[model samples]
Every structure is written in structure tokens, then in C-alpha cells.
Target chain A: MNEQSITLKKKPNLGRRIGDEIKRNFVLYLMAIPVIVYFVVFVYLPMYGLIIAFKDYRPFNRMGQGGIWGSPWADYYGFGNFVKFFQSPLFWSVIKNTIYISLLGTCFSFPAPIIFALMLNEIKNLKYKKIIQTITYLPHFISMVVICSMIIRFFQTEGILTKLITLLGGEKQNYMINEDAYRPIFVGSGIWQGVGWGSIIYISALSSIDQELYEAAVIDGAGKWKQLVHITIPGILSTIVILLIMNIGSILSVGYEKTILLQNDKTASVARVISSYTYDLSFGEGNSDFAYSSAIGIFQSVVNIIFLTIANTISKKVTDSGLF
Target chain B: MVYKPSIGEKVFNLFNILFMALMIFICFYPFWYCVTCSLSKQADTASLMLLPNGFTLATYKDVLAREAIQKGYLVTIFVVVVGTIINLIMTTIAAFLLTRKNFAIRGFLTWMMLFTMYFGGGMIPTYIVYTQILGLEGSILVLLIPGCISVYNMIVMRTNFNGIPTSLEESVKVDGGNDMHVLWHIIIPLSKAVISVMVLFYGVGHWNSWFNASLYLQGTEIQPLQLRLREILILGQTAAEGDAGDVSTMAENIKYATIIVATLPILLVYPVIQKYFVKGVMIGAVKG
Candidate 1:
């Protein structure tokens, strides 16, 4: 019996071991079946559908009748759609607008939360701080449609922001239609909407900071500004770095919802972004070039992946910490 | 140990107070303006500032009387309730499965879900798959089913689940109970805080989502409140521009009333559950 057991243990079959595990946890495996099927159908199937980027996909060609699989191949050796996008003038403008807006977001909106958190940290009055936090977080929960509507209304010809602009020695024009105002409206509204909610993580990080560090700083004759620079900033530096890396990773993926809601015919020239442009090409009036839009979508995803990888690598090298 | 403050610090403190007050104004004014403008009479909307000039509930009465708004409210309510239920169930199942340490293929499954967070099929392909392949065109199921499970939320839920001591789960096993019993009795009961957070996240997501509705249910009567709000507040704005009359003035009040109506439920509900959201953020930060 000992000899037999030794032989069985020595040459354990992988299939049998897997079978044994499944049998042992039959209920657990059964539970996992739905999730597995869900991912396969909703996620992987769509990924498989990405092949249409290479094919000249026609909706009229139903499945089993020259659909995504059976459609004619795109020109330029399956790179025709990408080639067309590259050659189009809309490509440059959208690319420029996307990068411009994303960069502005990174520069202004990203730091606004950090600064707000730092300022909140300095407030010793707890009740006042709580009140401020509660009020500020309200906008983050407001729907994009409502926020964009408020933005449009406030920037109308006789609107509040227009009046303010005129008071500041500017023309009383409807700023929503002005090409110059799109970026500011987008970025400013984003900061207003996000600052409070975004600051929550940083606030928690600050609280986790050891109080002894601040005491030591105080004992070292550090002033408020000095303590902020030396103690507080360093305390939340890692959180900031991780969040920054993530922000950089998703730099190209400016949410298309707000852009679609906010942009009109007058501002479309300046406001057309990659995702919105994709939506327009795919489902816009009289425009159903699925292959072309899919190519553009693939372009955005590829660049986003590149950006994420680069940011993660640089972060790991510089700070010895990364999202991965 | 009491420390004395410097004169410079006193000046800075005063400045900070004023700055915070300004921030409070900026943050609170938009909603306040909406409330005041919605309540103001048609003639008083233009000159409105600080407070309602000619207060009235006629705008809300007029806005709510619209057939489209009523339908939109029903659609959004159904979506939020049913969609959140599906979200919570799917998320709980996925999170529970992923947290099973000895579960075969757990690592592979986790990696599979995580990869989708980084890469997706993008707009056109996903659209084709949903509308053409799945035949969900103009169907509300398109909104409900596709986003039933957010991988990020699932990961957060899994992280929270992992924190529950294995001893508790083992006791259920000792009582001759199975995985479902342990989940239903122990795991879920102990994770109510995180689950509430999930509900809030998914509920707000469904409530605010308009893009998918616009894409999938365009021109349908089943559009959500946000989409209808967009039509009234944006498209309608453009159509009504350069006109001067009581008609346009009333239209302006209707826009404000629409904003308030669409946003008030969330505004009222959020502050009560604000702590859970903050806790949720903290949990997410732990994973980050």
C-alpha cells in the first residue's frame, strides 16, 4: 500500500488533479459559470468583432450573408481605413484638439484637486471643513447633461458668465459658440465638477500620515508653508504619483459624452474630439463608415496603451512604485 | 502643547477663510441659481441674481406636465432600479468568485477581466456587436446588460471581500454549510458597507448615463431623463435662439426647471449617503 501511494504521488497527472479540484468544488465552479459566460459574450465577443476594423464592414450584409466575416477587405492591404483617416484634415484637427484638451486637463484640473485638498487640510475647523466638502461634492454627482446645460445657459449672450466677461472688458458674445472658449469651458467646468470628489483620496492619504512628522516639523521651527512643503506634500506624494500615472495613461480617452452634449455646429470645428468624431463617423447623420470609425478607435486605443505603458515604466523607474 | 501663532499666520488664516467662502459660493451657486431661476416668473428670469425675483412653482408644473418628461422619468427609474439590481448581483458573484483563494483559474479570470479595463473593442465594433449581432437596437436591454459588471467596481468589491477573515467562512463550513450559505449569511452580511457603496455607484451611474441611451435608443420614446433634459436644455436652446417673447422667456424657465427636476433626486439622496462614498473612495485607494 505504501509503495502504491508513493507511485501515485510521484507521477500525479495534471488532468486528474484539475478534475479532482473541480469535483471537490463543484458548487463553486457552477457559480463561476455565469461570470465566465458573461465575459466571453460581452467582452471577448466584442474583441473578436474588432476584426471589422480590417474588413469593410457593411451592416446590410447580415451574418451568414457577407457580414463582418464575409465582407470585402479594406483597400491598402487592410489598412485603407487608417490610411484614409491619416490623409483627412479632420484627423489633424481632432488629434490636435484631443491632445490640447487632455494636456490642459492634466495641467489645470489635475492639480486643482491636490491644491484643494491641501487647502482643506489646513483648515482646523472641522465643521466648516465638512460643510465645504459636502457642498463641493454635489457637482460631481450632477449629470453631465445637466452640467453642460448649465454651462450653456451661463455662457449665453445675456448669461451670467457673459455679463462677467463684459464686466472684465470683454465683448458680450455668446462664449459657447466662440472657438476660443471651448477649451476653457470644458477644462474649467471639469475642474469645478471633479475637484471635490477627487480630493477625497488625497484627504484620506493625508489623515493616514503620521502626526509625529508634523510635530517634528513644528519642533524644527517650521512655519505653515514649510510644513506643507516638507511634511504634507511628501506624505501624499505616492498617492499623487499613482493617480498621475493613471491620468496620464488615460490622457487620450477624453470622455466623449460631455463633448457630444456640449458641442454645436459652430463649435464643432474646435470641439471635435477623437471619440466624438468616431461616434459621428459611425452613427452621425448620413455617415455610417463603420470601418473608418473603427480604425480611428483602434488608433486611439493603441496610443492610450502606449501612453499607459510609458507612464508606468517611467513611474516605476523614477519613484520605484507603479500601478502594475 | 499650545503654540503661539505669528502675525503672518493670522493674515494667512484670514485669507484662507475668504478663499473658502469664495469656493463655497462657486460650488453652491449653480444649483442655487437653478433653483431660483426655476422658481422665478418668466419676466424675472433675466434679471435674476442672488435670490428668486418672482417666485412661482408654475415652471415645475409646466415642465412635469410634458408627456416626454413623464416617460423619460419612468424609463430612468426602471433603468436605475433594475440596472442597479443586476449590477449588484453580477458584481457580488464575480467578486465572490475571484476572492476564492483555491478556486481553479482564479488568476487567469482576474487577468482576463483586468485586461478589458486597459483595452476594449472601441465604439464601432461594440456598437455593431450590440445593435447588429445581438439585435439590441432601440432596446433598453442594451443599456442594462452591456455594463452590468464594471471591472473596476468588481475589483474594489473583491478587495473589500478579501479583508473578511477566513475564520468566519471556515465556521460556516464547519456547520456543514456550503459556499452559497457562507456567502449569503456571512460574507454579504459583513460587507453591507461596501455593498451600499456599490449600490450608490451603480445607481448614480445608471441615473446619469445618457451617451449609451443616445446611441442605442435614439429617437425612441424610452430615452432617460438626462437625454430628455439634453433635448430641452441644448437642442431646444438652439432652436429657440434669437427669439424675444414671453414664449422664449417661459422656455428659459422650463430649462431651469428641467435641470432641477432631473438633478434633485440625486442631490437629495447623496448627502445622506456621502460617508459611504468617501469610504468607497478609501477602499479604492487601498487597491491603488
Candidate 2:
């Protein structure tokens, strides 16, 4: 044990004494310089500016805001913006809409790719499979603005979808302008755009399963369904769990940029999310409400963090897979 | 022997086929409708029916003829090329450096990258930093600079680099190769899969990006294609439906055409590079 400990201690020294590792690896460091400077300039340095959330910030009065620390602290107000946001009537409704939309998206859209991957797995014809995959994946690359535009055109009263709805004996109501239709449209479109591309990950996971397991199952008189349930799912569980945890972590972020692009005043009641609301507050032609928006943003981030931590903890306890 | 299905299994199969058909139709119909509608006459477009009332390229012609859109196309192309190059350089180098285990400060460096993943300074401050501090407010650099290194891309590339067999490195060193030579000669060649992954991801991201340009450029001349197309879509819809009356009917047809021009190139190019995309995503997702 003493000799082993001495060898372990000497090991690090041997590696270090090899040279001025930086000098030897100077090219690597040189390669890394731009990336390092980039992160510092773009990510870290701006992080110092998060302090503006605590300040009475105006773009023109930026220097006079006493540069964050010197500004009047939020301590005196005791989460005043937080309280104001909570007290606002839009808070609960927006929160409800967000949860409803995200949850609906999660329930419907999340498993869509998995189901897609499973189905694609069942398809033995490789050429047809490739063609289907290619066609379906196209939407994921389409710009949101264009996607939204296509959606708008397709749902118009005279549009094909609307005509089909009429043919199917449904009302020809213009759903795009309806507040109640927001969730369905958002979730529906999200699934359409995402499902095919999302399956790419799971398909890879499914592919990684040992071929012998399937062959053995087949030899054991097991069917495709049984093999899938017992072997395939279990093989992909850890990947699924990790992905699920990451999804849970970002539950608060409902891809709001797309949501914003899709939203109209009619849909805004049901569609406005924390991110969109913050966007409005920041860029809305009214008062420069930076503090309020930041406060809400901070609150949203806190909730996301809390949910992420709880999810990690619960996943670790239940399934032994988590981000941390 | 016939593969006879029991009633339950028959129902299951029916349900599966129905669901699959429904999903494919839902996924595909909107784009089909959009393309057909854009090609249709104004009367047909207004009717908005399944099939075109009459086919015409009038809208495409009108949209293509616009000076603003032509300029927007130029700007967008410029931004995408510059942005993707910057992203590749920054992310690939960072990935390379982080793969070296004995870098002495690897953990610290990694922690620095990871720290940015969870925390951000929010918009206003970042806006200030770029506009006020960097003086890139109205410049095209604003679009290119702020997002040079996506942490996600960096992590993916790092993992890819790490996976390259260490034996290759040893063999290179036996030939008396330096770090740069090894990286350029061996590591990069081996990393084509991941590098291509970054290229597609970063390229698509840059191509589709508009919010940064919207926020920063403020100049009509420098605005990207997506921004221009988005504005056209919004303006066209408003003019057609709303009482906002300064715009002409010609603008409506132009807007429809603008949508086609903005999207068609990417749609055309996607199928070409899509195989590489799938490969990249598969490789990244496995280790991701």
C-alpha cells in the first residue's frame, strides 16, 4: 500500500516534468485563443452586465446607472418587480398558457419522434425509409417565418386544410385567428416540424442495440413487439432518461421566438409566454422596462433551475440517470 | 402460410397505418399548399382552395424583381458565409484544445464554457455590451460576433475529438510531428464527420438567423433575407386583411413571391446535404 501510494504520487510528476506543456502544446493553445477570447468577450464579460437587472437601466443613461454595483440595490425594494409581476393579472394566465402549451407539446410532440423512430425501425425497405425520412426532415430546416407563413396560408378559409376540414364535416372557422386554437396550432405545428428530425437521435440509439439480441429473440419464438418492449426500450432507457431530464430542465423555454412569430393580438391572450412578454416589455415602444423584464427573466430562469434540479434529483433516485 | 391477423392485431395495424398516414399528410400538406398557392393566380390565391385555380408565375416574377429583396439576398449570403466560417474556426479549435487531457487547466477551461450554458446576462446588457462597448450596433458584425461559439457545438466537437484513437496521436508523434501538424494532418481528417456536423448545424443556424439582424442592423440595406421575407409576409397579410392602407395590391403579389424566393433555395439545397446531416446528428447524439 505504501509503495502504491508513492507510485501514484510520482505519476503526476512524471506527466508534469515532461516539459513546459504549454510550450510543447503552444499550437493547441494558439488554436484555442480565439475561442477563449470569444467566450470571454461574448459570454462571460456580458455576464457581468446581468447586474443591470438590479439597476434602473436606461440605454442612454447606462454610465449613470452607476454601473451595476453602485446602483441602488434591489434589496431595499425587496423583490419589488417580482411582486409586481406576480400581482399582475397576466401572470397567472400566461403561466397557465405556457404550462398548458408546453405540457401539450411534451405529451404529444416529445414521444412523436420516438414513435416515428419505432415505426421507421419496423420498415425493412431501406430506400422507402430513406425517402420518407428525407421528406419529413425538410420542415425542420425551414425557417420559422416561412413555416408560419405556410401555416397561415394553409389554414385560411379557402385553403386545402380548411377545405379538407369542411369535407370532413368540421366547421370552416379560421382557426389561426382564434385564441382557443393557439395551443392546438402551436403544438400541432411543432410536432409536424420536429417529429421527423427528432427521431434521428432515437434511430441512432435503436441502431446501437446489439443485433444478436434481436436474432436471439427471434430464435426464442419472440415477436417484433416483444423484442422491442423487452430489449429495445431497455437499451435506449439511459439515453431517453438523459434527454428527458434535459427537456425537463428547459421546460420553461417553450421555443418562444417561434411562438412570438406565430402570435397575433387575437392569439396573444393564450399564446403570450414569459419570453414573449419579456420581449414586449424590452422592445415594446412604451417605457423602457428593462428592470421589470429582467426581473421576470430572472424569475423564469430560477424556476427552470429549480425544476431542472428537482428533475435531476428525482431521476437519479428513480432511474439512476441525470445531468449532474 | 398467410400472415393472418387476429381482430385485435388487425385493429392495431389499422390504427398504426392511419396514424402514420395522418402524420405524413399533416407534416407535408402545408408546404405543398404554399407552393401551389404561390404559383396560383390572385383569384385562386384568394379562393385558397386545395388545387390552383390557374397557374401563373406572376407572383414569382414580381417578387424577384424587387430591389430590396435582391439586396437582402446578398446580405444574407454574406452573413451566412462569414458566420459559418467564424463558428467553425472557433468551435473546432476549442474542441481540439479541450481534448488534450494534460492541458493542466482543462477542468477550469471546461467549467468556464459550462458556466455560460446556464447563465446569461440577459438582453439589454448584452445589447449594451455589443452596441455601446463594442460599437457594433448598426454593423453586420453584430450578427456574426455575438454567437461565434455555441457551447453546445463546442461540447459535441470536443467529444468527437476525444473519441479519435490515442494510438493515432502516438504514431504521428513517432514520426516527429508537432501538435499543429498532427491536428491539421491527422485529427482534422479523422474528424470529418463531426466537422461536417458543425458545418451543417452552424451553416443552417446562420442561414436561418434573423432576430440578431433584426435587433442590430436596423439598416434596411444590410437586413438579411429572412428579415426581409418576414416583413413582407407580415406586411402582405396586414394589407390584404387589415385597413392598413398605404401599401399597393402589387406589394401583395410581391410578398407571396418573396416567400418563395426566401425559402426555395434552402429547400432545394437541403436534400443534397441532408445525408451528412443525419450522419452528424447520429454520431453527435450517440455521445451527446
Candidate 3:
């Protein structure tokens, strides 16, 4: 009787459990039907379009049937596009610029928010805290286009920022067009726009920390700095790790629009990152080398995926926190 | 009990308050500059004015007098309102579905959303799909459909939905109310704060969008305000660049005028929606 029951249990294993779940939640699945269909069409299907990176990518080849994936010349490139990218003249420049900008951002942009959150949390006055938070929060809501315009204008030869910089012995010309200035400008603007928004999560995390810990520490004669180090830092360490992992994973992705707008021939060597590069190559001369452009994009996404996986695995192993 | 602070604490507090005030000034200065330049006379616009000096509505008149700007404003308003409603419906229903316990496909669906967040077919493939396959090029639907559901926003909505007590839904179920009824009454009422914040977020997204319009709806009459703003601000054009390319005083004055006009609505709406955004983030993050 025991053996028979064990055999029966094996029969109702993982697949059977899933089948039973499907049967039990039929109505719930119905509620999610539209979203499922939307994801299938808009998201999953386009992911298959990444296959075009391997093909010659003729519209005619894709037109007959199977659409974006079933191109007649699927193997025409056969890693050729990726190989061409590696050998391309602009390859090193794009890679260098992308890494430089992203790393710069990861260093300054990531820490500014944490520091701001810590500072804001230290404020004892409620009114001053709220006013400061509100003022800082306003920048994140401003449109990127507007932000880019502001940056451009502020760095103009005669603008206020340029005036300040010139007083510090910088040249009296448009700093926006300076190739060497690209990384600094990009990182600076990123900090200005993102620090407040990024701080929100940390601040929220801070608010949820038990007040009794601080009270206890104070009763034990722990100073504010000691209390912050022992209690506050530990309180929000998990949030910090998760956000850091996210930042590291997305180290490859940057805003394409702002980059494009900011980029002219003057700063093209240092300014043209992955997304902007793909955008430029999308409709180049002589039949819009779709294969080449898609390959460049695939190259970017692959590196990003690699970085993301590394980040996830490391965080999961070390801090027991990760996105997956 | 309030703990007494040391002298070091008092000094720190004073310094922090002053630092915060300076930060606030830094935040407000650009908009202040834009407002002043837009309202100032052409000669006065070049000079740095902390306040609006020699203020006039002539720049506003010139900016509004353009035909494309008017059309752009109308289209932007229409898109933001309609698109946000669609976003709310999709997000709410999806969130509710995600929150359903013992959902067999929940894992699958969540993975799908997360995967999309990390990867995509890039812009060209999406462009081809819209233009060649879907035939949405040059249509306003291009703007609306391509970005109908933002994954980040969807996750926020789902997190909020998960935070709602199941007892509320259970009570509705005991009364013989189905999924729609539970969502319509229990879920929607409880989620007013998140929904409102999502509305503002989606509205701002639609308003600030000009890239898709630049790519797909170029030279169309239904171009959005941000595109028009980009033309004047970045492209440095006057009267949409083609109708009249007066690249001098009128362009300069109208540039700031257009910035103020395009951004003023958001500025006004921001304060009202600001608290909701903070609350929304807090609630979503707690469960996240």
C-alpha cells in the first residue's frame, strides 16, 4: 500500500501540479489574457527581430513570410556583421566613449543619491526637509529635451555657467561642443537630473527603519555619527545593494535622444555611444544597412546582458539580493 | 522624548539649512531665467536678469501666432488625455491579474515583463514593424501604440495591487461579485493614490515625447508640442523653421516664450501631483 501511494505521488509531480494550477485559476488567467497577447505581439515578437543581426535583412526577404525572423538570407552575414563592427574604424571610439560615460555615471551618479538621502534623513526640522526635497524633486520632472536645451544654453560662451568656468581659467567658448568636456557634462547633468529621484527610494527605506534603535543608541551615549554608522547604514544596506546591482547591470544603456542632440561632429569621437551609433547606422547610404545596424545593437545588448548576469550572480551570492 | 543635541549638531543643522536653501535656488534659477528671457524684450533677454525686466507679452504673441505651435499644443493635449486613460485600464487590469493568488502563468508573465525591461529589438526593428508591417507611420497612433504599456510603470501598479489586503477581495467574492466587480469597487477605490500618480507620470511621458514624432510623424500636422519646442530650442528655428526662418530677435524671444508655454502646464500640475508621486513611490517600494 505504501509503494502504490508513492508511485501515485510521483505521477502527480511538477507537470501535474502545473496542470492542476491551470485548471484552478482559469478565471484569473482570463483576466490576464489581453496583457499576455499584448506582450506576445509587441515584446516577444520583436525580440525575435534581433535575429536580423545575423541575416542580410532585405525587406523583400522578410516580406514573403515568417516576417522579421524568417529572412531568406538568415546566414548571409553569419557573424560577419559582428566581425565588421569589431574591425570598424569607429569601433574603439564607441566602446571607449560608452564605457567612460557609463563608468563615470556609475561612480558619481550612483553615490550622489545615497549621500543626498543620508543628508536629508539627518534634518531634524520637518519644514526645511520638505522644502528642500520639493525643490530637488522638481528637476526630475523636467523633460529631457528641456534639460538638454538648458545644458546647451548654460554652457554657451557667454552664459552664467561658462562665466563661472572662465573665472576658473577655462576657455571662453561653448563647453557643450568640447570633446573633452562630453563625459563631465553628461555625468554632471545625470547627477542633477537623477540624484533626487534616486534618493526617494533610499529616503523611503530610511523612513521605515525602527526609531527605537536610534533611541536606544542615544541612551547608550552613541553620537549621531556612530548611530548613523551602526544603525542607519545597516537599515538601508539591502536597498543600496539592489540599486547598485541595477545600476551595474544597466551600465551599457544611456539616453539616446540627449546623446544625439548633444553630439555634433566636434564631439563625435567621444560622444557617439552604442544607441546613438545604431540610430545613425539605421538609415545610412545605399539601402539602409539594416543588418549592420541591428548587429551593432545586438552587440550592445549582449554586453549589457553579460554585465547584468555578472551583477545578478555576484549580488545573489554575496548579499543574497538580486533582480532575477 | 526629544533628545537634546550637542553644539556640533547645532552647527551642522545651521549649515545644512543654508545649504538646502542654496540648492533650492540652484533648482529654481534656470526656470527663473527662462521665464525672464521669455517675458523680456529682445535687448533685455541677452542681459542676465534675476527677475522679469521690461516684461512684455509680445514674445508670447509671436509664439502663439505660429500655426504649427497651436496644432502641436492641441495634439499633445489630446494624446496625453486619451493615452493616459488607456494606460490606466491596461495597468490596473494587469496588476489585478498579477495579484491573483495561485496564478499558473504569473511567473511566466512576470518573467516576460522583466525580460523586456532588460532587452529589446532596438529602435530600427520597432520602427520597421510600425511603419512597414503595422502601417502606423505618419499616423498619431504611432506615438500612442508603440509605448502603450511601460514595464516599469506596470511593475509599480502590480506592487501596489499586491499590497491590498486579500480580505477585501474575499469579502467581495463572498457576496458573489466576480473579478470585474472586485476590481471596480474594492481595488480601484483603494488604489486612488497610485492611479492618480500614474496618470501624472503617463501624462508627463506623453507630453515630453518628441523622439517618436521626430522619427515617424515628421512633417505631419499632428506633431506634438515637444517636437515644436525642440525645433525652436535645439534646432534653433523660428516659426517651425519653414514658414518663416527669422533667425534673429524674434527667434530668440520666441524660444524662451515657447519654453515657458510648453512647460507651464506641467509646472502648475506638478505641485498638485507631487505628494502623490512620493506616496506612490513609498508604497510601491515597501512591497518591492
Top-scoring candidate (DockQ)? 1
Backbone clashes in model 3, listed as residue pairs: none
The superposed Cα distance between candidate 3 and the true structure at residue A291, in angstroms, equals 1.7
Model 2: residues with Cα > 4 Å off, grouped in runs:
A1-19, A60-70, A75-78, B1-22, B43-53, B167-177, B235-240, B244-254
Candidate number of the best lDDT: 1
* Highest-TM-score candidate: 1
Clashing pairs in 2: A158-B48
Supply the DockQ value of model 2: 0.54
**Candidate 1, superposed: residue stretches over 4 Å from native:** A1-15, A62-64, B46-48, B242-250
Q: Per-residue lDDT of B1-288 in model 1, one digit per residue for the tens?
A: 788899998998888888889899999998988888888785243343777767899989988999889999999999999999999999999999898888888898899888888777777888888877788889889879887989989988999999999999999999998888889999999999999999999999999999888888987878998888887788777555534332344467677888999999998898898878888888888777
Error of 2 at B23 (Å): 3.9
Query: Could you tell me how far off, in angstroms, the CA of residue B222 lies in candidate 1 after the best superposition?
Result: 1.8
Candidate 2: tens digits of C-alpha lDDT, residues A1-324: 999988777646645655667777777677767777888888877677676666665455645644444556564454766877889989998788778877897789888898888877766667867877888898999888888876776576655567767878978866677777678888998888999999998888898899999878877877667888999999888878887887887777777668767777677898898888888887766756766777788888888889889989999999988888
